[model samples]
Target chain A: MSHTYRYPRPALTVDIVVFGLDAEDLQVLLIERDGKPFRGQWALPGGFVDVGESPDDAARRELEEETGLSEIFLEQLYTFGNPGRDPREHVVTIAHYALVNLNEHDVKASSDARNAAWFSINDLPKLAFDHSEILKVALDRLRAKVRYQPIGFELLPKKFTLRQLQHLYELILDRELDKRNFRKKVLATEIVKETNQFEKDVAHRAARLYRFDQRKYDRMTKQGFNFEV
Target chain B: MSHTYRYPRPALTVDIVVFGLDAEDLQVLLIERDGKPFRGQWALPGGFVDVGESPDDAARRELEEETGLSEIFLEQLYTFGNPGRDPREHVVTIAHYALVNLNEHDVKASSDARNAAWFSINDLPKLAFDHSEILKVALDRLRAKVRYQPIGFELLPKKFTLRQLQHLYELILDRELDKRNFRKKVLATEIVKETNQFEKDVAHRAARLYRFDQRKYDRMTKQGFNFEV
Candidate 1:
């Protein structure tokens, strides 16, 4: 089937930047393109928006189809519509960013994706089509948002040590924090609750685990409680 | 001339929510449509993206051509691309929000806009298409963003009294802030510099005026200064 327009329209696409936390650094997901026009180049896992599907739905569908990642919450980041960004035509991409637990989303490249892998944000290769710029914007947003909101919990395990939580912030913010001050502020915020659990099977002493108290966070937010780190 | 695609593509457009402040309340600019499908209906001032034009450029051009607004910084808010948003065909709109000094920009309707006027956000007519939803989202963003960012300065005059500044926050946030706390926080941020000027032609004792120091704001932001009101 073919469709024609009196005036040419820019082809719409959706790109996603997925961030996950590993032991040492923050990571982003990239896929090797298998088609012409930047084929074999590493790019964000995304595709053209299908007809009858909303951009949000298209983002979710493309992420799952290409990278085997689903059920993750995706937030609309920005729209990149530079005329020559896509060599094939005037393709405008609505970019989105997501946070996921690395352990839960075991990626398997499928469909149009030649290969998919996670690269530490600190070290990344040249990306195809303005994706590097898009990823940079997403990182800036993540850094600013993580400080004021408790979104860092999305990148950690359900039960984690305070040290682990602090490490997540340090990685995202790219700065060292005073250990005592970090713990004091986090506990004072009361967004994380102590669990009657601790780590198992480690050479070093195990630390008690805590869970993010989402209900308390929501309640406190309603009452205008500010969360900062 | 026309172009054809192998698969149907959603027509792309841009919609902007321009916010300004009046003496009494926060206001939004709306244009009465002069075209079919929603003739005489109030809607956000926007139009279709022409070929070879970026969405950002399209937004600025449309805002200028339809509402006589130019040189305003427009931030991309979100993409609304649900099917049936436009009765004509599948259309995807990249939404943007901007802040303008009400006293500086004088809006005059042209092109497809039959009339242009400012309406208090609290009192708006039935907007065309999904604009009401779009406006609601913009309002939510503005309310949340103004709390942490100093964008509110765009609404007031170049030099304003502390009372006017407080009123801007109170109106956007729809709440009464403690006068002492608000003043202290504003002063401590150091983003607002006290001017050697005071209010002129007032019915009572004139209050001192201040100006938003963008240079100081940028420098302090680089040094990790967070502004909260």
Candidate 2:
């Protein structure tokens, strides 16, 4: 406690809300603390920010370390800086959120000496610290942002059918959308390319697959495209 | 130099990107530094975060202390925590941005012994530190947000003409919007209420004035209304 600054300094940490689209709803990644400070309670997959690393870097590293998930895109959500957010001391956590395809990564509870698991966002367990508040904010941003941004696609596989895409939107937006209108409006944006492939290993008829057209979306965005659903 | 901790703590600061609409273009509030570390240079109005205050409170206090403005909407934009961002030391800043109506506040350059000024977003002078990058991010967010959010009204007066609303959109969006289409789309949202009033002190035929109905907007938003341009 011998810091000589004009005022006391707060310990900084990073927390991430990783959302994945399950078959029926959205889910988030959580880690069961192996030790004290909310021990055995599930919390966001994050840790302290090392001395020289940026908060972003710390978030990415922590995501990989605790969840065994890497190479996913994450965006800064918000910073939670209440003086007593962390019971251990005066710690501030920069919260980040990311969308991921669950099929791509297999999550294990015991990785890197940490226990990780996936919990349905709507029915989450008792979270540690102020993590529940962080998750709520992340969900609100995901709901609002997917309307204009193409981030929802991150939760789906590269090749997906119109049904899967519609289901993804329905789960996040929490509204039943008309299938015809959803198809018409999405196609009008010209942001999706109809692939010749079809869904594999389905009990019913396999619907045609479509891929989000990154190049077309980028060009249209530059030309002032207003993406609304 | 006397801090005693398991890890080195980075100094924390708060920086604000204060935006305003000044009739012709979007503008930002900047302070001309009066002391060293960029003395006499233009920078965002901000300072170090006191230990006990949250970042949001720090931003509000700094905005008022340095610019003589308060009680406005300020949202946390992003946190910049890369090493070497501040030359003086290892400092991380939580960046915030706010929308203000220029008519309501009188900006002073020498308020509280600080030199504060508003510069047009496009014609801003070279700024001190990494403030230029911060300003660019804020402008992009503003342009993107105005299309879906009713925040553009923050830049306009309580009662404004449809022509004034259209002009504000064009200036922020940097596009030539068709008047007929703009009015039809905006009216369909039902967020604006037409007042039995007209613009005064204008040369041409006065246009009907309108006010954004906050209560209506809040209700519509609760029902999942999508506001898109």
lDDT of 1 by residue, A49-106 (tens): 9878899999999999988888886889999999989987889999999999987767
**Residue pairs in clash, model 2:** A109-A116, B109-B116
**In candidate 1, residue A200 scores what lDDT?**
94
Tell me the spans in candidate 2 whose CA falls farther than 4 Å from its real position. Answer: A1-6, A180-201, A208-214, A217-229, B1-3, B178-214, B217-229
- For model 1, what is the error of residue B14's alpha carbon versus the real structure, in angstroms, after optimal superposition? 0.9
- The TM-scores, one per candidate, come to 0.92, 0.88
Model 1 docking category: medium
Task: Please provide, for model 2 over A1-229, each residue's C-alpha lDDT reduced to its tens digit, 9 standing for 90 to 100.
Answer: 3345556788888999999888977899888887788899999988888767889999999898888788887988999998778777777888999888988867763368876777887789999999999999999998877766677888888888888999999999888999998899889888899989987898999899999899976775455444456
What candidate 2 keeps of the native contacts, as a fraction, is 0.44
* DockQ of candidate 2 compared with the true complex: 0.43
RMSD of 2: 3.2
